[model samples]
Target: MPLVAPVTVHKISGETLTEVPDLLAVEEPLEIRLGFGPITDRQQRSVSVTMRTPGHDEELAIGFLFSESIVQKPTDIISCRHCVQDSQKEGNVLRVELHPDVVMDWSRLERNTFTSSSCGLCGKTTIDAVMALTPGPLSADFSIEPAVLHALPERVRQTQRAFAYTGGIHAAALFDVDGKLLLVREDIGRHNALDKLIGAAFWQNWLPLSQFGVFLSGRIGVELVQKSWRAGVPMLAAVGAPSSLAVQMAKEAQMTLAGFVRDNRFNLYSEPDRVIIGQVMAFKA
Candidate 1:
């Protein structure tokens, strides 16, 4: 299905109302299921039911699994498929089968983990539990030029085909240390977009994202910070303000978090040692 849908909007200009055709980002519920055990004997469980953009459903499903630490690497998944044979369904259900012997905490997978565009830490019981999920303190010595950091939001925006068309979605893009756009995904929910990026990178065995960074189209939240940290990305930049939890988590993870990245300037929330402007200034993490 097409990622975007056409809709009618009423434009209001103080006293004038005009009907116009507009584009909207389509949001749908994607049921991510996990099937484990042998090829002949398997157990199925519904892990997450998330609201996401419809396209890239497989990527979304595997990405969600990876970011949530349900599966650590691409080889963990045996196969991924939508319930295409069920005529009663709209094909939103994605079942990911896992290789035998790959163990995960089944108890932690049962919460439904309902997340939204605005926040990703909805149902966690404690802050420490959330922090426990972050991969670890980063050890990458990579740095980005300030000009490279300043140009990221626009560069990421340039690849946001969905956001440019609909203006109603958030985006996440993964970039290498030298500021090359490696992968990009857009979704109504910010966390979902980042999940998709992380999942794709996992398939390529790109864990410990030591040489990479991420750019967000919306405000940085603790959840995004946590996901970026889990992926081992050294620098995280956004076009909006970050929350206190996000900054604090970034500091703990030793990840560079930058925000308000627009108009040729940006603010560094944590780990400023990774950004350079011709001179290598002394800084501590």
Candidate 2:
């Protein structure tokens, strides 16, 4: 069993003592470095230094790059490797070398400090600052039923392995057009879970997930919507409600956004045309 170092409190009663475990919050620092070689006159930029869990650092880096729109194609990334300048110390820094022909949009590169789950949009300076770096609209034309959206929560709940253990993690899952779960990742932070999932897809060379849909175990926020947009996900569903800004961004990005999905009931916030209401269970009933 995977173990999380949880803080415990002990209480002594009149007869016996009791111990209770608290949420385990671990902080590990990871550095991200961009490499394009010295020949192209492109300087290696240290983009972000985030405090996160030690596991899945590479995937986190790749997902962060994709979400930031730094690289489009998987081929654009030559390699992602861990570097340790000294033998005695364990380095959490990742050096990502891009293809010689690939060029990064440095003007849009933001988020210079630490990113916490509580606030995924803090480093963003302005709306234009974020919109300027986002990728184009999704290419998929599939539709999902409101009933299917409603059934997502049950499916996600059953598939949460880490949550079952620690009861303190969030998850992001990829579902096919048929509503079958494809991939799921859990992390202490909702954004981290999505990052891990997107990073896994990029590692498999599965660029542009417009054909598939993304489901979140939490509320739909602007940052999450932007990440899905950058990944080319045509439709995004969430168990909780979506923020007003998230709904606006989804509509602007031409992506289907659904929320309040739970117990076979959900509301279509934007692009209802992508949702086949007639195909949903609620309509059939």
**Top of the candidates by lDDT:** 1
Worst 10 residues of 1 by lDDT: 110-119
Pairs that collide in candidate 2 are: none
**Each model's TM-score?**
0.89, 0.81
- Report lDDT per candidate: 0.81, 0.76
lDDT of 2 by residue, 161-219 (tens): 66765677788999987789998887777777788789888888886887899999999
Off by over 4 Å in 1: 85-88, 110-127, 278-285
**Number of clashing residue pairs, candidate 1:** 0
Error of 2 at 280 (Å): 11
TM-score of 2: 0.81
Candidate 2 overall lDDT versus native? 0.76
**Displacement of the residue 194 alpha carbon in candidate 1, Å:** 0.4
TM-score of 1: 0.89
